[model samples]
Target: MSTTSDLGTHGERIAAAYLTDRGLRVLDRNWRCREGELDIVAREGDALVFCEVKTRRAVGFGHPAEAVGHAKQRRLRTLAQRWLAAHDEHAPDLRFDVVAVLVRAGRPALVTHLRAAFS
Candidate 1:
């Protein structure tokens, strides 16, 4: 894979581990539809979390989380609805999160998890 795609995949794996360590159970990764893709789907207690992961080697443009702006947030919301429609057994308790990962020299320098990132 290309460097950018590799970094994104690495970041998602790391993010999954980090969340699972904190008691969240991973339900899916890279879930895609015609609308878009969801980086991670997990359950934290009673809530279903739809996560967007942004990975970067440097922040020359902006922080990784900043990449998930309004447009992306809107898309995530719509995608979440699509996901829910496909899985009717899930509870309505839902949350949107953003995980920002910064890599340096092929190692993760920082990973930030922001829960309830948007409505």
Candidate 2:
């Protein structure tokens, strides 16, 4: 709740619930490896979704989803490959998604989900 990591964790929880409510079955949260971490892994029909959650108290700098640039997208892709190798799950499609959470002091957090955010 105090640190940025804590805020991120909070956002990820919100994102997971939101996705579930929308019918995506969450398979993993904070999945990690030597390469890096994936914020969420989900199944939506025949696709496997690898999601990144970004949270911020405000948007003075930029929107949270903007944080996932080209380099970060590449890393996520590599991490997705590693995750697939480590798990037994399979899907006919693969997707990358971004969940942006904006938390305010006196209001409920606002969540924006971007599906197929990258290749």
Candidate 3:
């Protein structure tokens, strides 16, 4: 991708497809609020899943998943609550997931799905 946003958008698309292929029905994408944006929202059976997608052209700094530290996780949790409130959606269980995409030149992007990444 030419820009970071483009790469991120591409990664989100791949992550959504990956989740669908794994049987999670996608509910929302790029859900935004005054707080922040949620990369993906999905469901698997009776559980509601909130996914954070991180994309990087290289891992010189660290893995993409590493980008979602405690602060980000906290924000995501708040966003999830807001999402539920806005949609009036209920689930017996809630989960947080992280989809890390590593793009390499001339090679397929590597995907790592960390389920229940944080509380």
Candidate 4:
């Protein structure tokens, strides 16, 4: 079994590839702020998307999307605001997305995309 960090890294890779295949240009990986971390920042047709990637070994800990509680959402929002402030330019349409990766034997077994995951 790979380490948790390794699983996270693999999940990010899978997510990036998935988004790229869908024509979303990835801008950044692991964008961080005082509030929290954003796994990926991407551009899709003039829209800025802040993506959260959750990786789990199985369903034992519950669904990955369910792990993102209200507090996490608030922090994500704060991080997104800081990201936009730092990358000040024309404000593109902003959105939040959640990509859950189910890993089994160190490989991605399933992937779920939740668009506009939070407010």
Name the top lDDT candidate: 2
* Model 3 spans > 4 angstroms off: none
Cα lDDT computed for each candidate against the true fold: 0.89, 0.97, 0.96, 0.86
Give residue 30's error in model 4 in angstroms. Answer: 0.7
Tens-digit per-residue lDDT, 1-119, candidate 3 = 89999999999998999999999999999999999999999999999999999999999999999999999999999999999999977999999999999988899889999999999
lDDT of 1 by residue, 24-72 (tens): 9999899899999999999988899999999888899999999998999
Question: What would the TM-scores of all predictions be?
Answer: 0.92, 0.98, 0.97, 0.90
Give the winner by TM-score.
2
Using TM-score, rank the candidates from best to worst.
2, 3, 1, 4
By lDDT, rank the candidates, best first.
2, 3, 1, 4
Q: Cα lDDT of model 2 overall?
A: 0.97
Candidate 2 lDDT trough over 10 residues, lowest sum = 1-10
Give lDDT for model 1: 0.89
Instruction: Report each candidate's C-alpha RMSD, comma-separated, in the order given.
Output: 1.5, 0.5, 0.7, 1.7
